[model samples]
Target: MRHYFNDLPKTALTAGYWLFVAYLLLPLTLMMSMSFKDANFIAFPIQDWTLRWYAEVLQDRQFLDAIAYSAFIAFATTVCATVIGVWIALVVATEGIFGRAAIFALACLPAVVPGLINAISMRIFIRVIDLPTGTAAIILAHTVHAVPFVVIMALTRLRSMPKNLTDAARDLGADPFIAFVRVTIPYLMPALLGGMIFCVLTSIDDFVRTFFLGGYKPTLPMLIFAKVQGGMSPQINAMATIVLIATALIGLYAEYLTRRARK
Candidate 1:
């Protein structure tokens, strides 16, 4: 009877875990299913499935352009965010730095700020600085939004790192810069790579900030949003499914790389 009671909790947890997985995956499954629908419009009963939507989406010039543009912005944002984040993490990790806690908090604040608010504030800030709304502005906004995540990841890795690694390098007649480049950077690679992946994902998915700062050229999210305004269709679903699959692949690849780095 006691074993049955103990097993009851385990069974419940197992059930709950599957249920949570279903909750997360069911919607995505439905969305993917819809992309294969034969009809132009979105509907259930997907009795007639076709690859026409996917075929058309692949041939779309606008879609291709948006994908390329978003990829560019994501790359730029990742580079900027990664550099700034690593710098901030180093500063916070250093001893005898003034207001280290405050600096860390401020660096991470943009992450917690509401997206709409951040977008609006960034719009105002750009205008105040006379920075025209375009690719530069969009990259700037994404960099700001992405920096905090990089900081947190890099900082966590930094804190867990042993001091002896760098000390050993220093004792071997290596200067601070050399030690940092050789020892510190290699140790921080997994974290930096993970952060860069996250930055890419977030920047690509960002719509609000991009919408506000975008000029004539449209990003992938912006293009998706514009299509959604027209109405939902299997084509749109196909586009979304393509993006979802691409991002998922990127995330999985990052996980593989991080695990490999640890080993």
Candidate 2:
């Protein structure tokens, strides 16, 4: 009796963990399952399971265009965000140009601010500047949202980097730029890679901000939203499932690299 009572917390925790996972994954499972169902409309007790929906999605020109556009934006955002973030991290970690807290706060402000607010602000700013909205506008907005993630990751990694490596490079008569490229960047690469992954994911998944900032071009998420409003189709489910699988693969690869780096 005493053992049972003592084990109650463990039992509860185990049950809670499974329950939480179910809460998170059940919907995804349903979506994936539905995607395979041979039906024109989304329905449970799925009948005639087939890969027809996947085939349909693959042949969709508009969907393909959206995917390509989103990928381009995500790639651009990752590059710009990674560079800007590394610069901010370097400044905060090495130079005392601005107080660390102040710099960090400003860098992370986009994360704290609501997405809608960021979207509205960017829209207004672009309008004020008479900048035509399109891929460029979307890229800039995504970069703004993504930079904070890179800054946080890069800063954490930079804080732990051995200052002696950089100093040693300088001591060996290496110029600052060369020293940074040779000594510092290698050390920062793992964190920078993680930040790149995060930034890509953020840009790919973003909808609210992209909707406002993207002028004529539609991203994957925007495409999904439009299709969903027209009513759920198996093709949409297939596209979503494909995206989910891609995201999971990327996340797993990032995790593997991070663990490998630690070793």
Candidate 3:
């Protein structure tokens, strides 16, 4: 009786965790199932199953274009965010930097700002600067949103780095630039990889900022939003499933790389 009571809380917590997992995965599982449904409409029965929708989605020219455009934007955002983020992280991590806290806070501000508000502000800022809404504008917005994550990751890694590594590099007669490139950069690789992956994911998944800053060209999310306006269909589910799988794979691959880099 005593043992049973002692284990009760643990059992309950374990059960709750699985329930939460089920809650999250149930919708995704249902959506994936619908992608295979032969019927055009989304429904529960799903008596007929087929790959027609997936095939159609694959043949979709607009879908292809949107995905490609989104990819390009994500790539650009990741590069810009990574460069700027590393610089900020380095500056903040270095000793004797003035207002380090404020600099770090400002760099990370965009992440805490509400997405809609950020989007609205970005839209206005671009207009004020006479920057037209297009791929460049979208990339700029995404970079702002993504830079904070990189700063956080990189800064965390910098804080944990051993001081001797850089000291030893300097003692060996390596210049500051060479020490940073060869010693500091290698140490920061895991964090940089993780941050870059996060940036790519967030940029690709972004909708609000893209919606506000987009020109005539539509991203994948915009394409999906446009389709949803017409109504739900198996094709949309198929497209979503493909995206989910691709992103999941990318995340797993990144995890593997980070672990390897750490080793």
Per-model TM-score, in order, reads 0.95, 0.96, 0.97
Residues 2-83 of candidate 3 have per-residue lDDT tens digits of: 8768899888898899999999999999999999998867787988889999999999999999999999999999999999
lDDT of 1 at 226: 95
The reply for model 3, stretches above 4 Å from the true place, is 1-6
User: Which residue ranges in model 2 land beyond 4 Å of their true spot?
Assistant: 1-5
Error of 3 at 2 (Å): 9.5
Residue-wise C-alpha lDDT for candidate 2, range 129-231, written one tens digit per residue: 9888888888999898888899999888888888899889999999999999998888888888889999999999999999998877789999999999998
| Deviation of model 3 at 207, angstroms | 0.4
In candidate 1, position 158 carries an lDDT of 96
Estimate candidate 1's alpha-carbon lDDT, on a 0 to 1 scale. Answer: 0.95
Question: Candidate 1's residue-wise lDDT over 120-229, tens digit each?
Answer: 99999999999999999999999999999999999999999999999999999999999999999999999999999999999999999999999999999999999999
Q: Which RMSD values do the candidates have, in order?
A: 1.7, 1.5, 1.4
Clashes of each: 0, 0, 0
